[model samples]
Target: MAAPEQTPAQYVPIGGDREISDRIEAYLAKRDGVDKLLKISRYASKIIIASSLFESQPLNSKLKSFESSVGVTRKALRLGKFLQSFNALKKSSELKSKRDFMASIASGGEGLYYFVEQFVWLSKAGLIDGKHSSRFSKIGAWCEFVGYVGSISVKWMDLSEIGEEKERLRSESDENVRELKMMELEEKEMMKRLSIVQDWADWLMAFADVRDGKGPLTSPLLLSSAGLLSALISAHKIWVSCKA
Candidate 1:
């Protein structure tokens, strides 16, 4: 249910006088950190651009430009990100004789999304013809939507299993052991719930993309809010890992 790259990192304390700066540096050392920050900026810009506060035409233009610039930069950073999904798929396959259906779907869809995204970026960056951008963008959005659906399903299954395990733990007569195990399961349940929420947030944005920003649910305010929420969740997870 967790992200493939969310494996726990060893805890290492920052010992310098500039502890805050050191922590910031440490966080930015991870790729996800930068991506999440940019995502926040991008979505924030979207919200501001659509807000009544930015009624000035020139200001709105600048806001739109900033959002577009941040978006393109994020895409640039993800140039080879599809390989991460491929690696996830490979790792999953190696772990079991029978393939996990939802996992495979998630990984495959994610890989395809990122692969198509490269062209989208290239077009946006002016390195390629922009004519195909719309088509590629639509395809990428659908792929992302598919991936999120698979991810949500996988997480739901994990949450169910965790619930079952917790139910079994109820019969454990050892007070201390039962409490500790229950606590662990509670933490895991909380994490899975967070992951599902994040996935749904992203799925909303993907829905907007596929709809070409047409529907009422795909309104700028809604999509921007969803994108910002998803970015914050991602950032929180990455920051936690940095401190682990």
Candidate 2:
């Protein structure tokens, strides 16, 4: 059998300085995003191993406490990155033009999809199944939280007033009225998205509450780690029981 040729990833040009691929790369390389995500995945795997040892000697208590701290830190880190990236994308001049904005959106959406896929892989390897692990539950919760925020952000971005004005420019008899209306609608949408982004950013910061050491009764990170560990332990127990 002949080997099939692999297609290269398509790159879209943005402006004179930035290409769509460059922006996507930059976004992924963001310290507040990728670094934290990797750390979270690493810790999540550790939690699974730790959970398995909980039945043994002195390791159980220490692992339990450490798991909580790791979980909180992960949640805080994710929330911070999500807010920063969302705001940057929303405010970019490149995103102001409909065509340019859509390109950026596609880049961002694809990047997030890739991140989530990696997350699922890590979960499976770490034995963080939702049915048996708290860590998996936490991961699922964080996913839902991110989804909610992303949905609202998209809705705000696709404001109808702005869309209508863009359409109006094509056929209106008077150029002056058309231009004025476009400006007004654009400004309104910008202000609305800006306000919503600000509020969401604030909420994420509160969720993390790095300084206070408190936020939700249990941090998402902690719950996720604990869940992952529990799942691994349960699976291990099941295997031992079957062998016995």
Highest-lDDT candidate: 1
TM-scores for every candidate against the unseen true structure = 0.86, 0.26
1-244 in candidate 1: lDDT tens per residue? 8667866888776566467676788899988799999999999988887665767999889989999899899999988999999889876765452237788778989999999999999998888999999999999999999998888988898998999999999999999999999998998898789889999999999988988988669777888889999999899877766752
| lDDT of the candidates, in the order given | 0.88, 0.49
lDDT of 2 by residue, 6-102 (tens): 9998997557446545555554555444444444454565655444644754565555556555554554345334444345445543655654455
List runs of model 1 lying over 4 Å from the truth: 1-22, 93-99
Off by over 4 Å in 2: 1-30, 33-54, 76-79, 88-244
Q: How much is the lDDT of residue 63 in candidate 2?
A: 59
